[model samples]
Target: MQTQDSRARPLLIYLHGFLSSPQSFKCQLMREWLTANNPHIVFCAPQVLPYPAIAQQSLVGLLEGFLRSANCGPVGLLGSSMGGFWCTYLGERLHLPAVLINPAVRPSRFMPAYVGRVLRPYSGGTQEYRLTEADVDTMGRLEAELAQPLHSRYWLLSQRGDETLDYRDAENFYRSQRQTVEEGGDHGFQGFARYCAPIVEFLFNQQ
Candidate 1:
């Protein structure tokens, strides 16, 4: 099969986890890999807001603009953690394929624990960001919308040893879709570089 990059310029959008930035390790790794192997591909990893509702709006706007500018091409998504939750939302809305790494299958279930003050280690500043009821509500909306899977267009990558989130949630949620359950690793997904090729293939090759 012909690669999407070979047919048209591929637009790959990387969505980082909550409190994470585009400067994340996986984002940088994918950027570097695309630069070296598929220079023709256009990669974008926009920095989204901390708030769930605001973040969804920002991502939707960014993706709309990207689609407009690209005109006609394959658009792929790569999301980790909370970003994965958003990715599933977008994938369902746009009928696009995505690669989710240790995705938060039900973020609303755990948002209550973080409803108060929180430190954003990736914020680059000492300031803290507060999670509000609206954030929790937004997560609930997203979670509710995910009641139905989008067929088999997703590539779920999870690690059994993920300390932050339960990998079984993703495993159970994406049971019918393509998935990789590793024996040992954390939420960061150690040795993620090894899957870059497969991720690219899965996202861009989907019909």
Candidate 2:
């Protein structure tokens, strides 16, 4: 990140995990915490579409547009689960730093099971999605887009007890990076709120 713009507030975009939304617990906690404690920081947690390709288009458009519309200051990225996959993609392309929480290392492997009509539980099951074989196959595009050493720009947080994802995958892949691997937390990254302040400090304050 460069010098603070002095024209607009710094921004932090939180990317929610698979089958999740901006309404997810962690996203809400981030929003509320910033509102109360760091109101100067701009926080955004867009509901990423389930489909891989479209989600990419929307997010890229959102971020690029935000930068074009305002002289914003430093930007931060935080992602969980599938969003972690995207946080890496976007962070790399934008040359920004990120903090990933139990992120999915190989979504294409498991996404095949989700290929077809899907119900998003986080959206009260109101959001109906169709996951295609093409979507499953395209997951690697984002993974392959990573151009830098994971340790150079990412801070990882994973737990051994994640039933949805194997924590070892992230631990091993992000090895040598600054990370925290807890003993018994689930895919939701147990006790996520405690790190909100520190996460902001890392993304906005650190190089």
lDDT of 1 by residue, 1-207 (tens): 666545657889999998888888999999999999988778999886668888878888887776777345789999999889888988887778999999998888887887887757474866578898888888888778776546438989999999999988899998889888999999999999999888888877655
> Which residue window of length 10 is worst by lDDT in model 2?
143-152
lDDT by candidate, in order shown: 0.85, 0.85
For each candidate, give its TM-score against the true structure: 0.91, 0.91
Q: Once model 1 is optimally superposed onto the true structure by TM-score, how far is the C-alpha of residue 97 displaced, in angstroms?
A: 0.3
* CA lDDT, candidate 1, residue 90: 88
lDDT of 2: 0.85
lDDT digits (tens) for residues 64-166 of candidate 2? 8887765767888999999898888887777788899999988888888888765565758666887888887788676676644653488999889999999
Q: After superposing candidate 1 on the true structure, give the runs of residues whose Cα lies further than 4 Å from its correct spot.
A: 1-8
